[model samples]
Target: MKRTVRNLLALTLVLAAGAAAKADEVLLQSAKSGLYVTVVNGTLAASAQDARQAVKLDTVRLEGNKIAFRDVRSGTYVRAGVGQGTMLATGSPHIRSWETFELDRTGRGEVALRSSQNGLYVRAGVGRGSHLAAVSERARDWETFRLVDVRNAGGHQDRPRPGQGNGNGNHNAGQGPDLSSLIGNYRITHVTADNGFLVPLGRELAGRARMSIEGRGNLSATAGCNSISARIAVENGRFQTRSQPMSTKMGCVIRGQSLVENRISQILTEARTVQRDGRIVTLRARNGAELLKLRRM
Candidate 1:
């Protein structure tokens, strides 16, 4: 019987019926308020209903809709109505690790290509790495998956650390709001300021700052010539940005080496509220302070 089941398990399948249910896993207890995570692939698994704090994630590395998480931590869950696009149409049938994710330990992950499919094909992350060779062209263009688990990637963390950066025995869990309304790319017009002043005095920023909504209840962004990372949270309709882990770069171009640093600090300090008023989404700081306005692009 086991042999029959083993034979029934074919590598061409993306996700099996029992994968989520039968996979080996450890219960994950979130540490911080909102689970801070990266999308290894642009495609997202799970559905709108499952986008709860128990299954929420963030993606800091992205340009437009093309994205992927660095890695989905073990037991890290996310429920998002997301999409995906193929980065490469050819060349050894490539599948970027960040573009694929799973929650089954024994499950085999692959990126199989099929005839008739061209361009970057996006898919759900549930069984992305698996069945890539044959399911590329036949799979749905987009699908909302509903399930959780990090599988046994061998790199997934056992669980959120305790007390290091707000991690405790119990995660700071909060029933976050539906962030889809708040989610969208915010074009950063100003690249922070300089030396306690406004406007940088050196070479303009390489990659401008950008904040986006990867899914409901989650916010992710980048800043400072692409040298910094931004992660935000929307719990109970209250928004909060995490402390930038990557410090602003030093050694400026004549406007003061600390110019960018100061600018980042100001932006960080001033940034608040993802407020919207009839198609105009404005991010302001404390009581209608100077805000950055954004629109659907």
Candidate 2:
């Protein structure tokens, strides 16, 4: 009977089933606070229902019969140190030895991740400045997390539907919202200032700077440091601006605001795609990298 069962498991169909169960995206929900485990500011924290905080458990890269969890946002590994507990940092020589985890599954799709470095399980530390901590590996409720598929989770911007025109297939019949309708004050919410870096607009900057999309393909923007103006082109949901946005040479006391101003202008110059959902507008590169997210003010 054992030989028969082994032969059955070796079948191609059975192997395919096993492969399907292994690769998946899951949000590690803390058992204590009911918050999902996510990496924020290079530290592990429990986020309140944000699907962007999801991480993937790599089935490959086995560390002594274990796996590794990597943060989707920063492309960094979740690792632990002897006294530092768990943190999100790039895999370097100093941290190369501690990036693996042993996944322990429980009933109802819940799991516990054990640190391969110290043989401790990750515990959700609650409250302000609370980060994930590695403690003694034991049967504890605080160490377990529910694996939630991001598609089922709420509070995140839905991905654009598969279509070529204006993000929602408005170009199906060449009918879409008028470009003049986009003329208004908008607040910058997110910025992909450079390659591989996504920076959420700081509260100070978000309120100070505003983007004004003029009806005649002209842009009048305020970035706290200077007033900016430029001409932009839009056709069939594609967006582009000629040359760099010209900014008034005004000096500012707050250097941070000036930096944000420059960053926003840089993104607008390279804008390739535009999508609007109600009062929110998202701009993306030709390659679909999100350049900016703006909310109508």
Candidate 3:
């Protein structure tokens, strides 16, 4: 009964507007890594895949395009200091003094945050575990971040308190890994069916199968004779095909092409969980069953 009620509530949240009406806990995910903006000690950074206290800042208020955020746990406002590339939280009484940021929409689901005081935009830094800094004049790819709807992310993940070891032994968890690193080309190694059976592609579809996920959520793939393309949403290490992928209408010439295309389409549409271990990425179903495995090329 409890599980059913929880599921119903989750469904209702999804059916409602993407962001909460108040926009209090909305997630600001870096367009480059998909990691959300967070606070480390006192410095502002983008280093969290899951919603946590460090990443859960409140939008205290918004006046026109100027917005201000406050750390929910610490109650300190995110302020930009002079010559300070990194932002910080402060308890100073002047909340609007240096906490104002200008929001500019770059594209669908993306925005560039410019400091109202410094006139510089926020950059999500390059490579893994990069600290965020407000030092750019242009809204480049690293400067733009997507506003992820926190309600859709099953609430925030609990973060370790200050002075407490990051719960897990993985010290790098606090520093967000580049989940978008999966953007490069990958070669399909094997396909795991819904029934938990692993089917090797072998020669007919082994080396020929290729997939590339663009930064804009566009997916392009080739499996033997079929060419497939689709728009997919990769969020919080999971992906769902937004639309039915388009493919070449030509009939399959190879013996395994038809089966491969069907399987690939199914996997792409139903994949829910994504696990990346170094160069290997595994896409799994909602039931925790592996659906497809790929290796970075």
Candidate 4:
């Protein structure tokens, strides 16, 4: 009888341990973009491809059925911006009003995050640098996300060390490619849609479209209409740019120049990966769509 009681206690302890592990970490995937929430330079972005690259967040349950997301990478809690500021960032070390959120589970196996500070819904702003913000008045498709339990789903792994590969044949140690090699002038040679159809550029504008990657993460480009500049970063084999790129206010007189300028800006802001082959470089979106092709100048 004593032995049987000891076995029952052991089983209870094991089950409790499993439940605790399952309650801690989760990967939040956006239902709108189908991308995972990630942190880029202390800001919340939703663009990770898989669980390996997604930011692991500790789910802290509160008393009122609310929860807080603590980014394991930065050791900071996710905070919603104040009045007139909608951007969400991860820098709060403690749980505050802005750091707490309500997790509303949809009936369809998804959830929405509502900020406790402003009562706004968090949204995955896809084209706008894929940054997350808490400005939605209502929970829509963009505000819906899937909470993936790390322990049960087998999605959690120790981050790869600086010199070790993550079993994907990439030897960069998950730090992304060296940016120094990509610093130079590149002439825009081709633009393609998602369906592989070439987007025709005006003859005059096509000849002058150019981009320059300077040191210190500065990128400037011109599609023959106006010049645009933005700060960029590469993290975990992903390319990221500022949501709002600064641009010149010049009016376009060249035919199709405005369209091309807008297209180029969209491509740069939405770029997910950078691939180089000799004198050619390609920028692709998160959906594996080729956005831009350039030749070294």
lDDT by residue (tens digit), candidate 3, 154-248: 67565543343221112232232334666888998888543334467888578788888888878887776878899877666666788898888
The Cα local distance difference test for each model comes to: 0.33, 0.59, 0.63, 0.68
For all the candidates, what are their Cα RMSDs to the real structure?
A: 18.0, 11.6, 19.5, 14.8
User: For model 4, which pairs clash?
Assistant: none
Residue 4 error, candidate 3, Å: 59
Residue 271's lDDT within candidate 2 is 64
- Candidate 2 per-residue lDDT, tens place, 5-57, comes to 64563353233323433445556678766765543333455654445434433
Question: What TM-score, to 2 decimals, does candidate 1 have?
Answer: 0.29
TM for candidate 2 is 0.48
lDDT of 1 by residue, 125-183 (tens): 33432111112333342211222343432343434333122111012223323356666
- Number of clashing residue pairs in every model? 27, 0, 1, 0
- Write the residue-wise lDDT of candidate 4 on 135-247 in tens digits: 88999999999988866645544464342212111223355555777889998877754333335455677698999987777988897779988888765557788556778
Better lDDT candidate (2, 4): 4
**Runs in model 4 lying further than 4 Å from the true structure:** 1-22, 82-84, 152-297
Order of the predicted models by lDDT, top scorer first: 4, 3, 2, 1
> Global lDDT for candidate 3?
0.63
- After the best TM-score superposition of candidate 3, give how far the Cα of residue 59 lies from its true spot, in angstroms: 1.6
Off by over 4 Å in 2: 1-27, 32-58, 70-109, 114-140, 148-181, 188-207, 216-220, 228-250, 266-295
Q: Where is model 1 more than 4 Å wrong at Cα?
A: 1-178, 190-207, 216-224, 235-237, 242-245, 248-265
196: Cα error in model 2, Å: 10
